[model samples]
Target chain A: MMDVADLVERARRGHPRAVARLISLVEDASPELREVMAALAPHTGRARVIGLTGSPGVGKSTTTAMLVRALRGQGRRVGVLAVDPSSPFTGGALLGDRVRMQDHATDDGVFIRSMASRGHLGGLAWATPQALRVLDAAGCEVILVETVGVGQAEVDIAGLADTTLVLVAPGMGDSIQAAKAGILEIADVFVVNKADREGAQSTVRDLRNMVALATRDWKPAIVPTVAARNEGADDLVQALDKHQAWLEESGELQRRRLARVRDEIEAIALTSLRVDLRDDGRLDTLADRVLAGSLDPYTAADELLA
Target chain B: MMDVADLVERARRGHPRAVARLISLVEDASPELREVMAALAPHTGRARVIGLTGSPGVGKSTTTAMLVRALRGQGRRVGVLAVDPSSPFTGGALLGDRVRMQDHATDDGVFIRSMASRGHLGGLAWATPQALRVLDAAGCEVILVETVGVGQAEVDIAGLADTTLVLVAPGMGDSIQAAKAGILEIADVFVVNKADREGAQSTVRDLRNMVALATRDWKPAIVPTVAARNEGADDLVQALDKHQAWLEESGELQRRRLARVRDEIEAIALTSLRVDLRDDGRLDTLADRVLAGSLDPYTAADELLA
Candidate 1:
């Protein structure tokens, strides 16, 4: 077993191997995870969490790279969690260009990681929030969570962020359709990427109209960008800053962080309880009772819980 | 204060109001739920569960209506659960067209209900599978569950079903894109709706190619339908029959049913555990520990579970 104190000390001192090993423990759900969490808890809750989500082919990865530069230019240590809830093979192919992400590869101030769900029920693997905690405790000043906006997993990522950016491209028939899918509710900022493309103006106009129609207390700012050319990065960073300021000034940050904690705690508790039930023979006995018509599932579950 | 025995007896006799009341108890997660389940346990496991899913504007509701007619033509009693995990208001709007579904609305042989998640973490509410069990025990020989295929909640529906039909429509730009999103893995059959529309043939061709490319023991049949015109409903039913026969002959039906039961039991047990944490002082104490940095969330959760 890895020593929790040593790992935490090394990870706090910015040891990449220690941090990576800590994350692996979280993913494998090792029994030593509790000790690890206790050790790292003190240094967390200081990072500015920014979530970037968009439909496939919207250039989210490229934009994430650009934002990493913007944050780095501001002298902030940055961490990127590239989360793919799609199939494992597809995620592998997508992350194969990790070398292209090498702009920060040699810089210890930037940490980039790829995470794919291991066939979890909610599209997000159960360990993502814990992994985020690891980054938070590792002295990262800004953490960017990047996920594709195809499933509720991305929405869960939004719940873990202080500010969420919804990226859209000009001609992929992705943005307007995204609005129809409730993507507007979670977005704190709207990014129209590929601004050099032909239909960028029309895309921005349609998005502005959609924003006008939503009855939100905090309206999402729409910005245009060409990440491949490093265009409009400043404006995008400013929008993020505006949202961050709003989050802090309105005390929404405290509320959101508290909710994230509550969710994390509940998830862990539930997972542990499931393991107990499945392994303690309670589940098999109940299943037998249910199958034999002596008891129903609800009653059997109640009995087990009691 | 309803009597469990009375309700179960009435529901078993196929009294619609009794079945509705039982479902309401399931949704509210009432205290008497266990008693109700115990009474109904003997009567379930007899219904054929079929799940139909697709993106918005795919005419799933209309397709459901046609399927209800075809099942009635087979002299079978049917139940329909329309699950909308998007928004309750949208669910209300979609089901308000009950007049448009007049073929099943007034038929004693058909029962239709709408269920929407009330902001549950999993795209599906915790109550759905229990509600399905209630319907099964209430003499529903065939149950059709219709849900939008865009999110993980629909994927949950696929897990609860014996047969899964993925619907696609012409001009929606849906099928191939959905396959890329991992929708093809859970499908037992694919229906290309709106065959009268332009590009229908190409849509069918693309879907057939995708299905052929998939490495599955049982090949998913592709059928064309125009639900608005009530065309090809028989072909769809035949395809369902073929898949059902395959499942039974391959012994996959028993395995799937057993797995479904185990999953249902686990979900109920875990939900109860979460309720205990949230309603008791345990969650607050753990959150306080996590917030104060005295204990990390993972360890705090382990303590609470212990």
Candidate 2:
């Protein structure tokens, strides 16, 4: 086994094997995780994180591939995290999608990983940010975190990125409506993928109205693209650049990064506490009393904490 | 304002206003929440919780109403918690759904409330179980928790129920495919809603195939229903009853309830701890160091906890 510090050092030099191993350590919550994180900490927070999210059929994977291609064209080292918060039951579904991403398989400049939450639902919440740190410290200039689904978990994961791109394909029935209102708030750029489709203009108009309704300093830009043919990739990249520029000028970038770190710290602490509560015999005893109606959950919680 | 004990006492008598008030307290996370929960504790553990989940536009609301009607015909008092875990951006969207539920407005035996998570993501996790406790103590024989979206949050909420009905409608693509596999494991029964639609039979066949793939002590039963016309509701009801019987006979009921209580306690304890971390100035200091790359999040989390 390689030493944690030595592994982090190799990762910092952009060794793909070292990067993959570090991410595995994060995923497994390995015993040396604390040392690994401390070793990598000083090198992180440099990569620009962009989150892409939409419903399943909205061409998120295609758009992601297009963006990765565009970023590589710009001579940038990129990392892609395709996070699936769905059941681990359909692991093959995501693997099939990853195979299509083989467009970058021969390109050493790009690193792509697909992650699915296994066992406990909290596992995703606990592991994703740590994985992001691995990519960031490994000297990736740009990291695209693309997550499946349009639910609250998607919104929560989108919050981890520096910029969030919300994708909506045409004829997907008010794709934004299916996306829920939270996605609108977090959207730094709206990509109307499959823009060659019939309802593309209408989807764009609807998103414009929704954006107009929200009050914020940086109005989210909507970029239309047919990601399958890589159409409008340049426009999407320009939109991303503009958003990053705005983030820096408005001083929101620092603020957002700080908030993200704050949340990551809090989630880690809470997860550790949750694991303790799970392992402790006292929780079972308290749950028994609550189940028996001799104690309320809140009182039981207080007792457990005490 | 009525005393907490008096409110709980009235709720036990199935007073509509009292029950509504108690639920409001849970939603607001009111100062008297702990007291209200303590007062209501002993009366809980009686209601049968049924969770209904499906993708958007799949007739979950309609199926839920139909089941409520059938259960009412059986002379049982019911409570419905329509939980929307979407962004509070479209409050009116769920309100519109709730207005349709006004069909049972005149019936004193029914209590329906629509809860949209406001502010934080953790808000829903902390509030839903307590709200269940409120309905459980208010003499509701069966409480139906109908949640919007087909994400992990829905799965988590479904875990709180005694029996979970996964709804799938025809012509909705592979409706169950869109629903993550975690949903399948949690489902006690599957309702092929919109059975009158063209593809209903095929949908049922697909579900049976999926169910056959998973080996469990109890294979989930798939029932077809046209909930809009209130067709096949009796079969749905029968399926639920049989599942409940199995739950009780196989000792799964006790185990499920115990696990639910254990989760409830853990969530409560973690939520309290989160509130503390949010308010304390130390977290901000830790976040700053993390942002500066002077410390990693895991180490910073340890410091915050210390």
Instruction: Give the Cα error of residue A123 in candidate 1, in Å.
Output: 7.0
Deviation from native of the Cα of residue A214 in model 1, angstroms: 7.6
What would the per-residue lDDT of candidate 1 be over residues B255-295, giving only the tens digit for each residue? Answer: 78777777777777776666677776777777766866777
The Cα local distance difference test for each model comes to 0.77, 0.82
- Reference A-B contact fraction recovered by candidate 1: 0.44
Q: Give the least accurate 10-residue stretch of model 2 chain A, judged by summed lDDT.
A: A86-95
- lDDT, candidate 1, at B172: 56
Q: What's the TM for model 2?
A: 0.95
Per-residue lDDT, model 1, residue B120, is 47
Give the C-alpha lDDT of model 2. 0.82
Tens-place lDDT digits, model 2, residues B1-306: 658888889988989999899888887778799999888888889999998877667788888899899999999999999887664333435666787899999899999998855664357777888898998888889999987654554337556888988787888644466443665677889888888889988888888888888777889999998899999999988999999999999999999999988888988898888899899899999999998999988889899989
How displaced is residue A162 in candidate 1, in Å?
Answer: 1.8
Q: What is the TM-score of each candidate against the true structure?
A: 0.83, 0.95
- For each of the candidates, the C-alpha root-mean-square deviation to the true structure, in angstroms, is 4.4, 2.2
Q: Give the range of the ten consecutive residues with the poorest summed lDDT in model 1 chain B.
A: B88-97
The DockQ-based CAPRI class assigned to model 2 is medium
| Tens-digit lDDT string for candidate 2 (A1-306) | 668778888889988889888888876777788899888888888999999887667888889999999999999999999887664223435666798899798788998998765654357777788889999998899999887654454237556988988888888744466444676678889899999999999989888988888788888999999999999999999999999999999999999988888888988898788788898999999999998999988899999999
- Model 1, position A174, has a per-residue lDDT of 46
